[model samples]
Target: MRILALTSWWPEPANNGSRLRIANLLRALAQKHEVHLVSFRQEAVSAQQIQRMLRICASVDVVPQRVWRPQPGEQIVSLWRSEPASVRATWNPEFAARVGERATDARPDVVVAFQIDTAPYALHVARAPRLLEELEVGNIHAHYVNQTSTHRRLRAWLTWRKHASYVQRLLRHFDACTVVSDNEQQLVRRIAPEMEAIHVLPNGADVHGCARDWGSPEPDTLIYPGALTYDANFDAVKYFISEIFPRVRHVRPGVRFVVTGAAPPELRVALPQAEGVHFTGYVDDVRSLIARSWCEVVPLRQGGGTRLKVLEALALGTPVVSTPKGVEGLDLKQDEHVLIAQTPGEFAAATVRLLEEPELRSRLASAGRQIVAQKYDWSSIGQRLVDLVAALAPHTVVQSKRHLPGQISV
Candidate 1:
């Protein structure tokens, strides 16, 4: 089958969660079918990167999209329009026009909008059955942003209402929809009752590469790896440094905390001036650091969707101590695959206990690795997606490939 995927950003520097998900999923889709990617390019992609993508995808089109800063007048106009958000409106015209032209010419079996950000562009792709991959129930994320971030409460609330209505209205036009978890699936169904085929296609990790054997961990070390520029992560690390890490340090003076990921300069400067805390701005690969650490910590107070950071850590045989919110969609059993701790005290205690108990760490790490290997590897997740697309494909387009594996209902 020929599939066209629309993304909000270039799916390279697959260092972040979303890009890694798209890149790996496309690689898997390309195994059995021809996949074409149409992405918004923030900066020019290098020739080397283009060739790399071409190896995985049948074709790749990067549409240059400028980041726009609207004036007060434009903001008022956006409010009056109340269709796409201001940020989304800036790129939609050019993006949708390109997608409309390509879909008309290629006439692919399916047109997949990877996230809600790309839905406007996907809606314009008129030549194929549309599939909207709702990476998160958008309103939930917006609500959390409003609750947690100090910079834009009013804007966040507005975004929340807009996204809730936008999703409900948009899903009705698509053939099928998908989300990262059962919770998100329920939210989508509730918001858009007219949509019948909403699949719970979760995020996955490269278990093989991350799961490779590593030497013994550095003693009393913990790592939290994520894009710190993201509001949730920024809040999390700050919260951890302020409330949680102090308690842990009080108990274990030698404990070392590594905040490893790309971060804004303001955030880098704002990092707590506490002993034993080191901020690694950005590392090319975090697997080695994850492998060398005693455990991974996720103290996120906001955000939706299954966290790829947690999944990657688990894939690398790293025991995790996270809040219930942190591991919300993964359906992980508390104390079985991970140690769940909610408050600062609980989190500190869990970290201290894990630091002292090598056997417990080994047990959780082993269990995590096994669980991810069985259910959350990219191969199985990608196949589930392929099956979903095949099911949604036109009978004339998919009938020729009936011999393929049967669809796995969500």
Candidate 2:
């Protein structure tokens, strides 16, 4: 089967979860079918990187997309517009035109759009069997509206309403839709209850890659690894510092909290002044950090989808202490594969307990690694995706109008 995979981001040396997911899936799909990738090139990718992607995929095409930085006048106009800020930002007429042209020429049996934002372009190929993959319902926006200060909350609420409506309308057009987890699938169904084709395809880890150097640590160092620029991660660190760390310090004063990720300017400025908190802006190899750490911490309060960090830690045989929200969508038992906490006090206590109990930590870590190896490995998860595309391909009808010039369909 010929499959066209669409996404805004693809793995190219950058260690981002979404990119890694796309790259792994494409690689796996390529093994069974003629897979072509049509992705938005937000950043400059080298020829070497392009070649690397081509080696994994049958073909790779990039549509240049500049993230629209709204001017002051445009920002004022956006307030009155029905479109969400993100929709407006990613809206590109030329890019859509190119995508349509490519899809028509490629004439794939199935066209899979990676996220709702990318659905607009993929949906333009009207005659193809379209699959919309929602990594997570724009929970960041929902989180903002629910948790922000009053002034920001009002703005976020307006944005959320508009985006929700937009996403629901877009979702209804797809032949089939997929979410990252059962939790997310349920949420998507709630938003678009009439859409019958929604299904779950949980996030997966590159177990073999993560487990390469799974060794026990000597000291009690807690590591939080993710894109620090993201609001969820920022909030997680803030909550840890302001609420959890103080309590943990009383119990274990010598322990260090290593915050590792790409931090934004605002987050960089608001670093924790506490003695034990070490903010490492970005690390080349996160696995190394995890290997050195006694346990991994995921204090995310407001984010949707299963976290790759948790999976990676589990794959690396590192004990994880995370909030219930952090481990949502995974069949994880508290005090078994991972330790779950809701409150800051609970989180601190969990961390302290894990730090002190080496045998318990090893037991949880070993169980977590086994779970990741058996269920969440990319090889297994990617095969499921390949099968999905193959099963859908036979029922796909290539419309006559699809070949006609100037007729755009998704």
Candidate 3:
């Protein structure tokens, strides 16, 4: 089976959650079938990264990424459009032309759009069964309920209504769709109650890669493996540094907090000041830091899909202490697979408890690792995606012979 995949993210620098998911899923699809990746080049993907991708993908094609920045009048004008303003804004004629041409020449059996961001392009792929992979709409809905001010709530509600209607309308273009968790699956059902075949496919980690010893755990240390560039992650760390960490510091003065990822200078400078807060800017492989930490902290207040940080931490045999919202859409059980805390006080207590109780850490670590290996490992989870997409075209024979570079465009 020949497959064409569209992505909003450049799967290189698989450092972030989005890239890693897209890269691994493509690899999985390419294992038994030829996969042609038509991805938006969100950044400068190195020659090394390009070569790595070609090893799995038959050919990799990239279109320049154009972010849709809503203009002043766009919101008011969107009220008159059939689709959301962002949807109209996202349509790139060059990307559409290229995708149509490629799909026509390659004659793929299935077309996969990685996220809703890529759906506009995927829609241009003529006469192929489409699969909407990792479609997430829950986080938008979360904003409506979580907003504090009435104005913010009303704004979020309006945004939610727009996106909800857009999502429902978008479902008409695909044969099937997948989301990260049962929670998201439920959200999709509620939004589009008549929509069927929504698969719950959570984000995965490289379990075997993390299972390797990266050295002993660092004493009195906690890690949050996410970049401060993302709002949720930035909010999480700020929430921790301002509210939760101080509480934990009162009990355990020596405890350290480590955050890994690139930080914008302004955002970095604006971060709340605190002792023992270290940010390792953009690690290519964060597994060592994760494995070396006493535990991983995820105080995420908002995000789409499941978090790979929690999954990767579990894979690294590190116990996780997360807010209920942090672990939303994951298979983790509170206190068993991970420790769940809702508020600043409870979160600080959970962090301190994990630090003090070595036996509890070991227990959660063992349980977490086991669960990740069984359910959240990329090898298994990736294959599940492959099987799901393959099911779309059951009768097609998978083309096993590798295509020579001379035989097709690379």
CA lDDT, every model vs. true structure: 0.80, 0.78, 0.86
**CA RMSD, predictions in order:** 5.0, 4.8, 1.7
| Per-residue lDDT of 310 in model 1 | 88
Once fitted onto the true fold, the runs of candidate 2 whose alpha carbons sit more than 4 angstroms away are 70-82, 138-141, 144-157, 214-216, 264-266, 395-410
What overall lDDT, based on C-alpha atoms, would model 3 receive against the true structure? 0.86
What's model 2's lDDT at 125? Answer: 83
Score residue 209 of candidate 2 by CA lDDT: 83
Which residue ranges in model 1 land beyond 4 Å of their true spot?
Answer: 68-79, 138-158, 397-410
Per-residue accuracy of model 3 over 1-410 as CA lDDT, tens digit each: 89988888988878888889998898888888888878888777677777777878777777787788989987777776677787787777777777887798788899999999888788888778999998888888887888999989987888889899889988988899999899889999998887898998889988777767699779999999888888999999899999999999999999999999987789978889899999889887889998999989999888777888889888888999999888877888988999999999999999999999999999999999899988888999888998898799988886673764612222
Native-to-model Cα distance after best TM-score fit, residue 102 in candidate 2, in Å: 1.9
The candidate maximizing lDDT is: 3
Cand. 2 TM to true fold: 0.89
- Please give the lDDT score at residue 274 for candidate 1: 84
**Measured by TM-score, how close is model 1 to the native structure?**
0.90
Ranking by lDDT: 3, 1, 2
What number of clashing residue pairs does each candidate have, in the order they appear? 0, 7, 1
The best candidate by TM-score is 3
